[model samples]
Target chain A: MKRALTKRIVIDGVLTAMALAIWVVEAQIPLPLPVPGIKLGLANVVTLFAMFALGPLDAGVILLVRIGLGSVFGGGLTAFLFSLAGGALCYLLCLLLRLVVKDKQIWVLGALGAIAHNAAQIGVAIALTRTTGLVVYLPVLVAAGVITGTLTGLAAQASYLALKRTTLLSRLKGGASLPKEPDDVAGEEDETEKKNQK
Target chain B: MKTWVWVVIVAVILAVSLTVGVVLLTRQPQGNVAYVYVDGELVYQVDLSKVDQPYLYTVNTPYGTNVLEIAKDSIRIADADCPHKECVEQGRLKGSPLVCLPHRLVVKIAEDDADSVSR
Candidate 1:
């Protein structure tokens, strides 16, 4: 049991590191639209994956660490506020999404989470700038959010599916015996995911 | 019901937003008063139609400074100390706020009555 606990900590730490790297790299890319607060949100793929594969707590940790470190590395206090508000909004919605959809439909989680993130960001921008004219950008921002969210969601789904094939996940259950076949793992997921929803 | 179905619904919503955004972007802006804001406080307001000659106004903040070029019927960021210079590249503001996230600066156009409501 102790070994399993250690392994989970190690995995969460690694996921946090991975998320930070992705966030910093994505910030370097020049956006085509020249729009503020719009990006592919590639780092969210890791957060979404961790949310589904590990649990909400692990996902929240990874997200907080990434945003806290990301802003220090790439932005200032104002940018940090925006990221915090957006990330918190996204995570809250993702948690509620667990009840509405099955594991196979992570795309829904991604799209909805992205939309929520953008909405919160817009609210922050408007508040910080004291200009209601920023609302003019909402439609395009929402459009971008949906497209990027769906893309990242699909990527997270692929990673989740691929990870399930390995015995690494089974180690979480007190390092139990590995499932011998792919079918065995798939069948096991059907049961655990249902329990996870509640 | 299926994953693809969810994707379709999101796509449709995206399409509607895109259409609306494009329309808004292309529409002509009617406001003559341009307001510049920093960290949620109104700093400057100019009537574009009243400017007889083009001028540069520099706004200094703890984050950075942005030089705004004001002219008849239009205003833009002539220069900025922010890293990306996105505000400068934004060219001119017609309707949407020219936002500089790095410097926490925003310049936008609004009607006369809009000013009282926001303040």
Candidate 2:
């Protein structure tokens, strides 16, 4: 039992590091769009992957650590608040989404999570600045979120599939320690069988 | 649900948001008067049309400093001390209001009548 706990902690740490690295690197790339709060959100790919490979609890831990450290390294207090709001919303959405979404459809979680994240950030921005004029950016942000979210979602789905082919995925699942709820685990075996057949 | 159902739903959302975004982005501002607010309080109002000479307007808030470039018939963030500098990258004010989220500073072009009514 102790060994499983250690393994889970180690895996979470590694995923957190990967997420932070992606966040820092992505910040350096200047997006052509002049709008604030718009980016590829590539780091979310790691979170999405973790959510499926491990579980929501592990994914939440990785996301929180990444956002906390990412803010310290790049953005400061304001960024921290915005990220907290956005990340929390995104995490909750994915938690609920995990039930219905098939492993192959991880991109759906990614896309919807990105939209929820962006919308939450906009809500924070509006509340902070106390400016209703900022609403003008909503449609643009939603459109951008969908496109970027889909791309990141596809990336996460591909990564999950590639990893599933190896023994690593099973090991990580074991390391997660907590048994998944029966409902959550339902259809998973069938999905794997379908994939194996293909 | 089938994967195709998810795909179609996302596609429709993408289509609608893109259409609405384009329309909003391309729409012209209603007036030439620019209102600058710091921390939700109105601080400065400049009529872009009346500016014969371009000048820099600096806003020093508790969050940070943002410098606005007010030119003939247009305004933009010339400089800002914020981390991302997204407001500066926003370029000249068009339909969307320029926002410096970190600094809680907003520069928006509003109709003269609306400005008077609010005051």
Candidate 3:
């Protein structure tokens, strides 16, 4: 049991490091859109993957760490607040959506989570700037969210599927035995394992 | 739910938002008055139509500095000290306001009303 606990902590640490790296790199790449509160949100791919593969608790820990550290390394207090709100909202939505969304439908979580993230960021922006006129950016932000969210979602879904086929994920999950087949039964077994972990 | 249902729903949302966003982007402002606010407080106002020659306007807030290029009937953020410089890249003011989120700076064009009060 202690070994399982240690392994879980190690895996969470690795995932958090991966997420922070992705976020810092993504920040370096300037987006073409001049609109504020819009980006590719590639780190979301890691969050989604962690949530679906390792369950909500691990995912939440990874997300919070990434957001907290990402802000500290780059943006200051205001950026920290914005990311906190957005990241919290996105995590909550994904947690709720996971029950209804199947393995292949992880992209739905990505798209919806992205929308929630952008909307929450805009809310923060409105309150900070005290400018209701900022609502004018909603439609554009939503459009950008949908496009970027789906892209990241698809990436996560592909990663999840590819990794599930190998023993890598099982090893990460503290050497818990995972079914090797890539079929509906294998998916069901994974779900049962997740339920047991919960 | 079927995968197709999710696809259709996302597609519809994308289409609607894109169309509305485009319309808003393409629409022209009805007035020549620009109001600049820092942390929700009105700091400056400019009558763009009255300016014959372009000039530079600078605003310094607790967050950073933003340099605006005010021209005849148009205003744009020429530069800013913010990390992304998104406000500067936003170019000219149209129907939408130029927002520098990090600095809490907002520049918006107001409607032309002969007797409108500025609060």
Candidate 4:
């Protein structure tokens, strides 16, 4: 019991590290928005992946670590405050949305997370700017969020699937491979996917 | 996948249409008016609608302070004992005056339809 819990703690720590690394890379890209508060929210894919690969608790930790490290690397005090407010709200929204979706198709949840993150950031910007005109940009930002989130979700889903095919995910899920093969799960997924393809 | 494509297409269309609408709706940009107050009294006013070409002018606030002007319409702080330069960005009345909020200084364009926001 203690051993399994320790393994989870370690895996979660590694996942958080991976999330921060991805965030650092994405920060280099300078995608401008018409308004001040919108961005692609690329790091969210890592959170969605972590949520499925591990659990929501692990995902939340990864998000906080990435946000903290990302802000420290690029932004100053004011940016940190804004990111904290926005990132916390985004994570909470994602957690709430996660209940509806199964682990297989978590991208929809990712889309919602992306939109929520932008909304939270815009809310913080409005508070600081005290300008209602800035609110007009929210719809456009939400629209942008949907695209980026979907892409991130697609990437995450692909990675999750690929990892599952190997012995790695099986070992992670259970200490040892079960007597009977768990190939049926993948087979079932493929059958449904084929129908969708048609 | 079909739904996703439609979503992206709609987002693109909406963003482009809204931006174009804002552009079409905006009237030609115009300069601002300059008002001066002294001893808590209305001392003078300058309607810059007729003023053309780049110019700057210096004026005093109620606090007996002199602000600087760079050109016909550009202004800056020649000198200000005020702790914050929030007003410094307000430079010249190309549109608005140097606004010192703590000092209650408003250097802004007075729109013709200031009452009506909708075009």
Alpha-carbon TM-score of each model against the true structure: 0.85, 0.89, 0.89, 0.60
Model 3 residue A85 lDDT score:
90
Better of 3 and 4 by DockQ: 3
Docking class of 1: medium
DockQ-derived CAPRI band for the predicted complex in model 3: medium
Interface RMS for model 1: 1.9
lDDT of 4 at B86: 34
lDDT at B54 for candidate 4? 46
Model 3 bad stretches (over 4 Å): A174-198, B114-119
> Which prediction has more favorable lDDT, 3 or 4?
3
Total clashing residue pairs per candidate? 0, 0, 0, 9
Q: What ranking emerges by DockQ with the best candidate at the front?
A: 2, 3, 1, 4
lDDT for each residue of candidate 2 in A1-198, tens digit (9 for 90 to 100) = 786887678778877887888889887877776567676677888899889888888999999999999998978888888888888999999999989999889999888898888888888899999997777777778888888888888877887887788655786677544545533433453354224322
Chain A agreement with the truth for model 1, given as TM-score = 0.84
Tens digits of lDDT, candidate 3, A149-195: 99889888887887788666776565454335435534554554333
- Residue A2 displacement in candidate 3 (angstroms): 2.2
**Candidate 1 Cα errors over 4 Å, as ranges:** A172-198, B112-119
DockQ of 1: 0.56
Q: What shift in Å separates residue A25 of candidate 4 from its native position after superposition?
A: 2.6
Q: Put the candidates in lDDT order, highest first.
A: 3, 2, 1, 4
**lDDT per model, in order?**
0.79, 0.83, 0.84, 0.57
lDDT (Cα, tens digit) per residue for candidate 2, span B1-119: 99999999999998998899888887898988999998789999998899999999999989899999999999999999998898998899898888899999998888767434643
lDDT (Cα, tens digit) per residue for candidate 1, span A13-131: 77787778878887777675646766667788889988878889889988998899888797677668878988999999999987777767897788888988888888888887776
RMSD of 4: 10.2
